[model samples]
Target: MQALVTVQHPAHVHFFRHAIGELEDRGHEVHVAALDKDVALSLLDAYDIDHTVLGTRSGSLVQVALSQATIEARLVQLARRLDPDVITAIGGLTAAHVGAALGIRSVVFTDTEHARLSNRLTFPFADEVWTPDCYWHDEGADHHRYPGFHELAYLHPDRFTPDPAVLERRGVDPDERFVVLRLTGWDAVHDIGDSGLDGLPGLVRQLESRGASVYVTAEGELPDALADRELTVEPSEIHHLLAYADLFVGESPTMATESAVLGTPAVYVHSQPLGYTDELADYGLLWGFHGDDRNARGAERALELLDAADTTDWDAHREQLLAAKVDTTDVVVERLLGDVGATGTARTATARADD
Candidate 1:
């Protein structure tokens, strides 16, 4: 099977990395087309994966709209050249729309509880819409609900193992209590802009008071006050650090989910409405809050959760994850092959599973 994977954000690169490799190992030829975001390109390089650059631009809604024509033309050309058996889009809407327009079978992975504006444009058009059970979006019974999150497919012990050498490379001491703080600059619906910095000082101070070393990373630049501990490592390496960290505090859901799957306690605060919080909170692994909730003392609250956290049930969570392990790459690849009437290649696809 020849496959083309489309990625919009850096997080989606990580999300599809293992899946792509798994597909290729099974004898499927996989090609990646992506916007040249700094983090996304960095991760692709770090992993030594070959991919074509679609284009580069600010990730604002306006930029997304403006780039549609260019992106579509590239997708059409790539599809003509690659002639993939299937196309899987990591970023939800854009990939779906382009893939569908080209008459290619496409799968979109989304975990949002509610539909974003993009979903309205793309979900109905996708060959398949894959979402975590926590996702509540439905497009007239077309969406397919998966039992797990993307974080689990990658972070589950069955698939991922953290390397402490990543920490060594970042000049972090293994003995130190590491706390990851993710600062977000993109908030379409809310003004979660630089004001997150206002709470950072207090949050950092509180964590420091507890003898925790705070490390920050952001989509945009961090404030001068928090730059001292800012993470400068490659994107893929950040995941390993989160795995080794004692706790994580971020406004990014992807990081929060990554931390939780790695057994790190996480508190994600942002003003945007979050749908996965309820499910993650139930797992006893994540805490969530709106950025504007002045009463919500995230740092103090994080410490309280950390202090009271009982890992007594972590084994159960791990067991649950293991039992539900769905090699997402394999699932999607098989489905794609099936869609293109490549059933005669079944024995070949199964052979790739050995990898």
Candidate 2:
């Protein structure tokens, strides 16, 4: 089988990296195409995944639309050349459109229910729209629910083992209490009205007051106050450092869930309430807060968690979560390879015949 996988964000690379390798190992051909989002192309290079650049994200919403249209046109041309049996992506707006134009199958995966605009544009055109079972929206008969978070596609024990060398390389003591903080660039269409890390300097001071060292990472540039704390680790190995952190305090749900999946307690202080995040909180693996005062309240909550870190049986919570979730890469590989009840070629034939 020949497949085309599209990645728009760095997380999508992680979500599909293992599946791409698995497909190739099984004698199937896989082609990767990506947007030049933060560290996305770099991550692909680090993972040694061959990918064609679709286009770069622009500074404004209107420019983003124009960029995507250009990217979609390029994607359609690439699809014509490859004649891939299937096309798949995370948000999948472009993939769905290309598939529809060519009468091919497009499978989309999304865990974020709050991506309303992206979802509205992609769902009606996709052949299969897959989300975690925790996702609460109903996109009608095409919506398929699976028992795993996107993080599981790579972080599951079967796929990853945290390296202790990450601590040693950074000169971090294994016994030290440290926090990993992530901040995202509020540039996406969904992030228009939302805010994150309201007072970056204040949060750093508060974490310092509790005697915990903090390391910061962001999708955008760091402030002058945070310049000293910026984490400069390789994109592919940042998860190893996150796995060893005492706590994760961030604005990105993707990082919060990644921390939780790696057995680190996470605090997401953003205003978004994603279903997977809510489910992770239910499992005691994450704590989240939002609203106008989330920064102050979130800091207080982080202090509380830091104080109780010694007594919290985090491994037990992680074990329960692992027991409840399936290896998501298995689902991705099956769906893309046309083993999810209908092969891509079969679906393409049916789609053409219907016309």
Candidate 3:
């Protein structure tokens, strides 16, 4: 099988990185078209996943639209030459457009129902829409729900193991009590009205007072107060830090979900509620603050957890979550290998070892 995968965000790279390798191992042709967004291209390089550049992601909705058009045009030309049997992506907008233009099957994998504009644009043209079972909406019969979160694709124990030496190598004690705080650049279409962490100085001070080393990772500019707190680790190494961290307080739902799946205490601050994040909260693996006072409420929750006497049993929660969910890479690779549709065996092969 020949597959074309489009990666728009850094998370998308993690989602497909393992699947790409697996497919190649089994005699498949895989091509990646990546957008120069944040650390996405850098991650592709670090993971040794060769890809063709598909323009850069820039500011403003208007610029984003124009860039999308240019990308779609380039994708059409590329698809004409490659003629991949299937095209897939996280949001799958450009892939859907180009697939429809070239009459190729486009498989869209998304867990975010709040991506209103992207979904409306991609779903109609996509041949298949793959979402987590926790996803809130139904896109009719074209939608296939799987029993796992997107983070499982790489973070699942079968594929990943936390490296504590990463901490000592970075000049930190392996057993040090540390917290990972993340901030996102709210430039995406869905994040227009949503908010992330505000008053970072105050929050950082409070986190420091909790007697843990603080690590801050942000997309855009950092406040002067947090300038010295920025984490200098590579994008790929963030997961290792997250796995060992005492707590994760972030505005990026992806990181929050990643932290939860890694059995770390997580607090997500966003005005919008995500089905997976909400479910993680239900499992007592994460706390989500999603109203107008999201920042203040989220900070309070983080502090309370840090100060709690009866601490959360993160390992137990993680084990419970693992018992119910599959390694999502199974689904991604199966779908790409033409083992999908109503008769797909991916759903039946949830046990990672079953493959």
Candidate 4:
């Protein structure tokens, strides 16, 4: 099979890197097209994935317009040249719009309710939509539903195991009680507002009170107050830290899930129109709350949970994650390949004017 992938975010790049590798290992011809997401491109280059460039960036209004125009031109050209058998992207709006116009099979994989906004609005025009069982969007038309999230597909023990070497290379001590805190850059599409250095000081005091070391990571601008705990390592290496951390706290939903799957107690505060956080809580691995609730008192509550946490139950949570495992990449690819074959036959018939 011949396939084309479009990635708009750094996370999508991570998804594609793993998905494309799996596709290629199964003898499929895969081509990736993406914007100039520095982190994404860095990971791609590091992994040596051959791909075409579509100059776009997920940023400011003016930058967004320019990137869209650039992507529009590049995508149009790519479709004509590649004449791809199938095109798949993770909620890739650019790809969906272009593929719909070309009458090509467009497959969108999404897990979050927020990411589905575009997909729900534009999905009727798409050839297929794939999402986890947890996704409950109202697409006007019927779409294929997959059994797993991207995290489970790639990070699932059956498919991929995160290597601790990433931590060793970053100078992280193998045996130390560390807590990972992810500070969000107050500039996302849906930021939960700022906690400033005040929140950090309190949290640090609590962690230090418990004889734990703090490590900070963030996608947004780093605050001067937390400079001492800054982790000077690659983004992917952060996972190794999470895998062994005593606790994980972040405003990032992605990091929250990563922590939960790694069997680390996670607290995702603020940051959004809540989506998977509640579902994750049901899994007995994560805790989440609104960042803006004045009376939320989640920090105090989290500290209490930490004090009463059962380390022996960590393995139980891992078992739950394993039981919920589904090879999402394989399932999504198979569905898309099936759609591509069906679309090809329909196109042939329509060309003969047999509609």
Which prediction has the highest TM-score against the true structure?
Answer: 3
CA error at residue 147 for candidate 2, angstroms: 0.6
lDDT of each: 0.70, 0.88, 0.88, 0.67
Order by TM-score, highest first: 3, 2, 1, 4
lDDT string, candidate 4, 1-355, tens digits: 8898887666776566766887788898988887776476776777788878888555665676577777877997998799887787876577777888787778777666754345555576677666555555545344545445576655666655667677777777756777788876554332323342236767777876777778888776666877888887675566677887878877777777878877788887763533456767777777776645622455665576567554448768777866755555556556656643344332332232211
Q: What lDDT tens digits, residue by residue, belong to model 1 across residues 1-355?
A: 7888887778778778887887778788889988776578877887888999888655566776777768778878888888876788754565677677778778777776443566677777787776665665455555665456777656767678888888998899866777888877664322424243256777788877777788888888877888898888777778789887878888777888788777777787765545566677777777777656632577667888556544345546645654644445444555655642254333332333222
Candidate 2 accuracy as lDDT: 0.88
RMSD of 4: 5.9
What's the TM-score of each model vs. the native?
Answer: 0.86, 0.94, 0.95, 0.86
The candidate 1 region of ten consecutive residues with least summed lDDT is 346-355
- Model 1 stretches with alpha carbons more than 4 Å out: 187-197, 309-327, 339-355
User: 274-314, model 2: which lDDT tens digit per residue?
Assistant: 89999999999898898888888889989888999999999
Clashing pairs in 1: 26-352, 270-291, 271-291
Query: What is the TM-score of candidate 4?
Result: 0.86
The total number of steric clashes, by the backbone 3 Å criterion, in model 3 comes to: 0
RMSD of each: 5.0, 4.5, 3.0, 5.9
151-252 per-residue lDDT for model 3 (tens digits):
999999998999988877887675878888999998878898888778888998898898978888899888888889887888898899999888999999
Count clashes in each candidate, considering only residues at least 3 apart in sequence or on different chains: 3, 0, 0, 2
